[model samples]
Target chain A: MPQRIGQYTVATPSRPALLSYAAAVGNKEGDGPLGSCFDYIAEDTTMGRGSWEQAESMLQKTAVQIALKKIDLAARQIDLIFAGDLLNQCIGSTFGLRDFGIPLIGLFGACSTMALSLLNAALAVDAGAARYAVAVTSSHFCSAERQFRQPLDYGGQRPPTAQWTVTGAGACVVGHGEGIAVEALTPGRVVDLGIKDANNMGAAMAPAAADTILRFLKDTGTEPGDYDRIFTGDLGVIGSRLLCELLDKEGIDLRAVHRDCGVMIFDRERQDVHAGGSGCGCSASVLCAHILPEMAAGRLKNVLFCATGALMSPTSSQQGESIPGIAHLVHLRA
Target chain B: MKPTKKEYDAMTNKASPPSPKGKNSVFAFLIGGAVCALGQALLEGYRAWGADLETAKTLVSVTFIGLTVLLTALHLYDKYAKIAGAGSLVPITGFANAMASPAIEFKTEGPVTGVGVKMFTVAGPVLVFGISASMVYGLILWVIGLFD
Candidate 1:
């Protein structure tokens, strides 16, 4: 049974292990700073698919296959799979994993789907609800652009605060055996700060990220210094800066310990990724490709992985509704 | 103490870097001028080939739209547009791209619902306002003629 801590944090006494993980990314992401960290890089983003949506589905399928292959486990061996993507109806996950024959719980946390799915998988494993659980999430630049912003070939200039959607996918397998331990989890509340600009998602999500991180730290009785790294999912440049500023008001100095997956995934100056890499895959692939690998190598010990998400759609934005943001936290120790 | 929504928004604005407007404007100007110059050259060429003024003008537009559609199909227009910004956007070529991109992208959803419906998504507002404003202008001109 999971123990309830102060406010929203839940302590996983059993500490379910993260058994295996893998990441697959597109050419752009593969050319980035952490390019070598990924298990597979699709030189052709379409993966020879007829459409961008199908290409996105292929990314998810490839990620899950690589993850399961790492531990020599078949898809049937997985008890439950929690998966999601930035596509409408999460067709990326559904179409990709449908043939696997494993039961799946589809989530829709936008970019935070990676962390949200991971936290749920960890909790379920800890409770003995399933012998093995898999968490997976993905995003594609072409697919996301057509759905959220503009057509791929549309000639529009992106603002300085606009983040490039990462064309990648990540998958992780969780079980009770030996691996990185999932220690604690903090589920976030939907925080809306009246941010209406769709381009500035980092700013829109920063408040929720700060709120969740603060709550997690307070509930766990841990300082920023205690964790080797506190990773925020896809906050990019603006959100990362704002998150530090917001935490500073509470007398917590997070500047030194904080790292945003969005910021780390791309070389902003060289890649022309104005703000930084974003979308569900920005955090998902970074975790599987870089962060988890670093932890396994003994370079990192205790870490807080908080993935933030902007819960808004094109319809919602067009209707003049403000974007509501959410962030979920998971504490991992090796 | 937690800051109010207004305060937080202000903080966000303060933290975000401003867009490079001055540099972008220069690029936009150069690119937009180049596109216009190409159109003029094409018009001159058509006229030299013995076409009438109206025929040459129509040929210039047709050639530009056709070339834009081809570049869009080859996935080259967007790359140029990224650097050119408004240079590529505020032209006859831009309108062609606006129509062609969704047609290419949503073709997987089928010819009818996907390409046909989504074809006007981006340019629809521009078309709507353009036609509406022209109607208002025509109405004002009709009123003036009656007074005359």
Candidate 2:
């Protein structure tokens, strides 16, 4: 059995190794700062596919393939796969990996799917459930827009608070070998602050991020300065600011080390991304492409990665249901 | 971790209704009025060209739709929509923009599924209700005719 640090699950006993990772993004993302770090960028959002959904599936498939190739491992060598996307029933994961024939666990944590999958993969490896596991998730802007909001051609003006869903996928392999190791896991509880505005996702998810981080610190007896960096999934500009304010109320300030994946993925000034990037791919791509590389290069030693999600559907929004948010955290040591 | 009832209430209560009423309404009025005036001008142009009232009206509608789609493709209608609000939304050009916007956006999805399927996303409901209302009105007219 793995040691429990209060409610936090310690992964030291299993020492699940994060061996390799890969990220694939769309052309718009390729124009961003971390563009060069991505393994591949599709020429267009469609990726030459018949539908945006199909293009998203291709993105996930390519990410998984590239991740496996990085470690020189075949699908057969992997014991399990954890994947998801911001599509109906997670069709992106199901259809994309269907050909691989690897036993897969489908997840739906909205934008938090990436961290959720990573945390699950690390735990599974620690529990000796699999020798090699993969965590993957994807999101496509066009597909997400059609599903969650208006279609692209609706010419609806995106409010300043609204975020652009990133079109990308990221995959990482967790195994029992030498590399960056997953240290601990903090699974967040769903928090509903009764925020009904679908456009202001950052504000909706900020309290959850703050709650999860505060809980993790409490449970582990750690301070905010323990980690070199604390990265929240896709809180964007507004959410991150709100998170700081909330944490200030809790008597802990993370302003110095806190960086959001949403804020980091795109150049806010140059890119037309209103608030910032959001979706499963936002954190997934940034972590695999930028954060992990920094760790491997010994530029960073410890990181707290927390991905937050607003668990609301179009149906829920239409029914006037408040958006519930969840944030999943993983401690990684290089 | 669960927040206390007080905490939850505080968070939810903090939500403020966000809007700049005076500015938004002004922009909407100006932009929406401009769209309607354009349609009026087009209709008058056709009438001056010696077209009948019915023909002139049809030409005006066609021209509005064509111009809306062209603006949508150029990504300018969204800017107008932002300022005009319901003003831009109330005109026939708004409906055309609604249909054309999704079609152009989904063009990369291939003509069949992408552009074809999503073409009706915004306008579908309007069309359904519109046709149904007209049918019910026609049925009433037939009933009145029989009574007469």
Q: Please report the TM-score between candidate 1 and the true structure.
A: 0.98
Q: Write the per-residue lDDT of candidate 1 for residues A1-334, one digit (tens) a residue.
A: 7889998999889989999999999999999999989999998999999988899899999999999999999988899999999999999999989889999999999999999999999999988898899999999999999999888887778899999999999999999999999999999899998999999999999999999999998887889999999999999999999999999999999999899999999999999999999999999999999999999999999999999999999999999999999999999999
What would the per-residue lDDT of candidate 2 be over residues A1-334, giving only the tens digit for each residue? 3578886545557679899999999999999999899999999888898888999999999999999998899999999999999898999999999999899999999999998999989988988888999999999998998889875646555666788899999999999999999988888789877778899898789888998899889988888898899999999988888788778888899999999999999998799787799999999999999999999999999999999999999999989998999999999999
lDDT of 1 by residue, B32-98 (tens): 9999999999999999999999999999999999999999999898998988999998889899999
lDDT of 1 at A183: 94
Q: Which regions of candidate 2 deviate over 4 angstroms?
A: B1-30, B70-87, B101-121, B124-148
CA RMSD, predictions in order? 1.1, 3.6
In order, what DockQ does each candidate have?
A: 0.79, 0.35
Q: Which consecutive 10 residues in model 1 chain B have the weakest lDDT in total? A: B1-10
lDDT tens per residue, model 2, B1-148: 3455467545534532345567777877888788778888988899999999999999999988888899888878877787677777888878999899888877776799978998997899999999999999999999999989
* TM-score (all chains, Cα) for each model: 0.98, 0.89
- Each candidate's chain A: what TM-score? 0.99, 0.98
